[model samples]
Target: MLNFLKKNIALAWAKRHVSQTENFKNNAEKLQEELLLSLVKTAEKTLFGRSHQFEDIKTIKEFQDKVKINDYEDLKPYIEKVKRGQRSILWPETPEYFAKTSGTTSGSKYIPISKEGMPFQVKGAQSALFHYIAKKNNADFVNGKMIFLQGSPELEEVFGIKTGRLSGIVAHHIPNYLQKNRLPSWETNLIEDWETKVDKIVEETEHENMTLISGIPPWLVMYFEKLTEKHSKKIKQLFPNLQLIVTGGVNYEPYKDKMEFLLGGKVDIVQTFPASEGFFAFQDDYTKDGLLLLTNHGIFYEFIPLEQYGKPDTERLTLKDVELNKDYALILTTNSGLWAYSIGDVVRFTDKNPHRILVSGRTKHFTSAFGEHVIAFEVEEALKSTVLKYPAKITEFHLAPRVNAESELPYHEWFIEFEEEPANLNLFKEELDFQLRNRNSYYDDLISGNILQQLKISKLRKNAFNEYAKSQGKLGGQNKIPRLANDRKLADLLEIYKL
Candidate 1:
């Protein structure tokens, strides 16, 4: 009875919170303008501010003119100063925490979470649940055990400020009300080895009335696999009460069929778009295809059209200026002291009134070896299209251009690890190729012009991608397989795992 009452209270609060967003969405432009000015004014006296003249950022256009789009390399110096305990380097007051993330060149990058900015990160996640609860008119999941497969919550200090992976950092902030319902004991969560931690998690919650599970799709698939294996039963058979799943980090299309098959019953799905930088958006309606972009989340957003991304004097458009369906590289100026930061992700707006979006691809993660410029969204959708007809289950996959195929024409090489291999591999490949061509005209032109061969698929052994990630010291915890690479580095590395 108490649990039921608690759920009703949560539902009421969620409905209210969701209702509040209607006004924010209606006045998003005005709100975003105010947010940017507020951020600039707060940081104006800081080191980066003083240099960039943030005090003169009285208008949005002026702010953009003063602060050029900046990548991580551009802000490294100021970040290093913050790491060494410099006060007011980027924003007033030292950051309360630094979210550590793996970097390609910098080894590790520490993103600040100001005392003020941290709530938005926490609330963004909460609001996602609120959206779900309000839309579905149910919060019964709040009464059951919920688990978020994530990084270890243990923290290390960087100059007296706590530092850890974004997931780990967020784990510490799970609300007091939800504490009892949250699963995986603190000791198990502290286990660093993802393989070992998953085992412990399975043992701890296999019999619980697990109603909600949240994590990236790949890792959640891993957990579900382990759970089903241990109990020798499907998810529905094991946890009959399980009702909700929240997933993020990657597109759910490729894994959707497999995940549903594993579940073996009906369960509501919620998608989210979160990063170390911030929680950007989440699925507002179960019926909608895209996530509702958080306009009031203390992050001012800018979009650079993908075609003009790398060129000099690129145009940056705000939400008011963006068009539907066209891909744009996302940029952000945040209260966390990240100014004009290039977030590297590409997004396509799906709606204008409520400003919903789909994460299309990464700015850097693409295959343009033959000038086709195939993005992650294209490849994932292609595979999804094929899977719908072929009926195969994918564990994971990666795409790379095989430029130096000695005996064959240079082609896109897809290394796919399938949970269940299709009976007709050749037909599946052809369909996938066809789907890709349909989605990307450039790829079709290249194939027709004899510049490239039809793309090739290299089947991978079960758990090949998992093992590869483990070998690379990135088996889990926000590490995702490279969906597309222009070069052969990842392709060469994955060659040995091919079946």
Candidate 2:
């Protein structure tokens, strides 16, 4: 009865929010103006605001003019100051906590989570489920446990402020009533050893009525493999009532076939765009073409075309100016005191009616060493196409550009640790090269002109990536092997473990 009531209330709230989404599309300019005004007004008294003269910002144009765009480097000084017990530096009130994430260029980053911003993150996550329930029109899944495979909730204090992984901080905020229906109890979650925690999770949930499972795709795949190994049966046999799988933090297309085969049947898959910076978007419709942007979530957005991203005079477009199918880097100015912040992820709008998008790749994750730009989306699609044509299942893989004075031409090198190798290795390479060339015109041109050689493939020993990750102390919980590198750093590392 409690679950039913909660579902109904949540569904109603989600339906209302969905209705409001249309209003956001229709009056996007007005909504953006209001959001910008609210942010400026609220932070006008804070240190960052005073330094930037936020008091003079009464319009979007004024706000943009006064505040320069920023990446993590620009805010590192303020973040460090706040960590030293400083108050009102970036936020109106001191941050309640800090969420730490591994930075790509930098070592580690600490993101402040103000008290006011906490609810927005919580609400954004809840909105995902609510949207799912509203679309499915069934809430029976709420009765059973929802297993969230996540990192440790154990937190440390940095100058009296709690600091941990974003998911760990979120775990502490899980409502008391729902705690009974979530998996791997706080104790198990706190276990730092991923292997031990996975065992505890398997022991704790092997017999429970699990209806929903949510986590990053790779970790969930690991859990499912473990469960199948332990039970000697498909996951559907163990959890007959399992109905939904919610995944994010990485693309799911590459893992879809393996995940479904493990389950023995098709299941509802919902993708989300959640990050330590903010909960930005979620899969709302069943079509799965793109994610619906959370327009009213106290985040004002800007988009810079991928080609113009790092250029000095790049034009930033608001919601009203975005076009379909053009890749753009996402920028945000939020209620959490992140002003004109570039989050580094690239996205392309799929639908402009309600502003839906597909995350294409990271600004720093692409490879364009020889003028043949290859983004993550194209690489994933190419791999998926190749796998469908050949008898292969990729367990893990990484790509990097190889340019050497000894070689006649530059080439893209692939280091693959395969679960199932193809019958003809040469054919597999040819098919992969063909697929990538067809997907990327620039690559095709380079090959045609002999500027780039055929892609090189190297098979790595089994569990090579896992061993490398463990060595780096990033074995589990949101840390993923970088899929593409402009240089040979990853290739050199994987070469050491070649089969």
Candidate 3:
């Protein structure tokens, strides 16, 4: 019965709302007004009148002017208010769930997600599913059991509510009705604690014919590797009808080839850009280049020119005014009671009306050593091309800058775990170095002496990084193996790169 509902409800919504969905492409002004109205209404009730994060800004423009541009740093005050159990700033009463996100340190962010926000997540996730079904015209496979690799609670209290991170909060919303109807008999609790659920999730997902899978790229990669090691043939044997594999949370380019290898064949893949703040976008179809924003749902959109958003000067733009194909940083006013919130991801629209955008990278993940700026996506592309040249099976890797004191050039060090041992590791480095330079000429020029000198490869024991993450209490559901690090600080725990 639930499978019947899962298959039919989404299609019914799409059919009845075909014209509305079409409005996504035809009318940008109408879409923006609807979103703005939702934002202002939610804001008036939650902020201005209630929440303290926003005060004294009676009009939308005034609120936009006074709030300033925000990153996570800007959210601290609001989070603290929530921590103090003050309902005066955002919403009334304690939010039911908090989504946790980890940064470089143990300073995990606890973003409050209300019950109101849950519907957006549910529907946002559904968009990826429905889009796939609509494109493939395959409702049979859509009715199958799905697996979501998710984080467990690290601590019981976050933002003054008994909460964890967004992944766990999302886990809580997996409707009981769906669980009863769709989950296989083979599921297990991967999250033993908040810090140690990644490994346990890998252990649990093996051999299951995962019809649908969603999680961060890092965690999915680790899970795929483990699944391939023990149950590679079994994966195809058991899940012959497997239809879709969805992943997000980080850039997907680095692992795309390897993910295809792990699944034993090509499978429909959908990428999503979702933060603890709100549902941003989902891949429009299996073949589209960008994600379609959930324009009429969840949150209202605002874009500050990427340059202007962080700058002290320029004003932000509303959905109606954003330029096409230009980079912009997003500020959101959400139904979850977060107002004029800066979620800190950078996005660019590929299409104007239907509102398709590519998530370029995070604001923090850029590399600027020697002023040879390389974004995470660039680094990911370089690594993918580099890895493709070698016969070695790259189990895992972390890329970081190693500054040479004598020459002043910053070389790249790749700490990799390989299945096949290579005779001369320097060969791997030379090829990788060549590719990096070709991809980014600045990377090439810097390599002679004043730039990067060489690329270094370090081999790790199988699952060594996974074991290390387990030690740090990060093993289990949805924790990804750290693929790249900007600095050498975390390198000491990882295996050293060989010349």
Question: Superposing all C-alpha atoms, what RMSD in Å does each candidate have to the true structure?
Answer: 1.1, 1.9, 4.1
List clashing residue pairs in candidate 2.
none
Which parts of model 3 are misplaced by more than 4 Å?
Answer: 1-19, 28-30, 45-62, 92-94, 103-106, 153-160, 184-187, 190-210, 231-234, 304-309, 314-328, 387-392, 419-431, 438-449, 477-486, 495-499
Q: Which stretches of candidate 1 lie over 4 Å from their true place?
A: none
Q: What is the C-alpha lDDT profile of model 2 across 393-488, one tens digit per residue?
A: 888889999899374788999999888899898998999999999989999999999999999898998889889888878888779887887888
Model 3 misses residue 299 by how many Å? 2.1
Ranking by TM-score: 1, 2, 3
Instruction: Tell me how candidate 2 scores on lDDT.
Output: 0.86
Instruction: Kindly report which residue stretches of model 2 are placed more than 4 angstroms away from their true locations once superposed.
Output: 1-22, 405-407
Clashes of 1: 0
lDDT, each prediction: 0.90, 0.86, 0.65
lDDT for position 458 in model 1: 93
lDDT of 3 by residue, 276-316 (tens): 78888888755667888877676767887765655676768
Cα-based TM-score, every candidate: 0.98, 0.95, 0.82
2 against 3, candidate with superior lDDT? 2
Clashes of each: 0, 0, 24
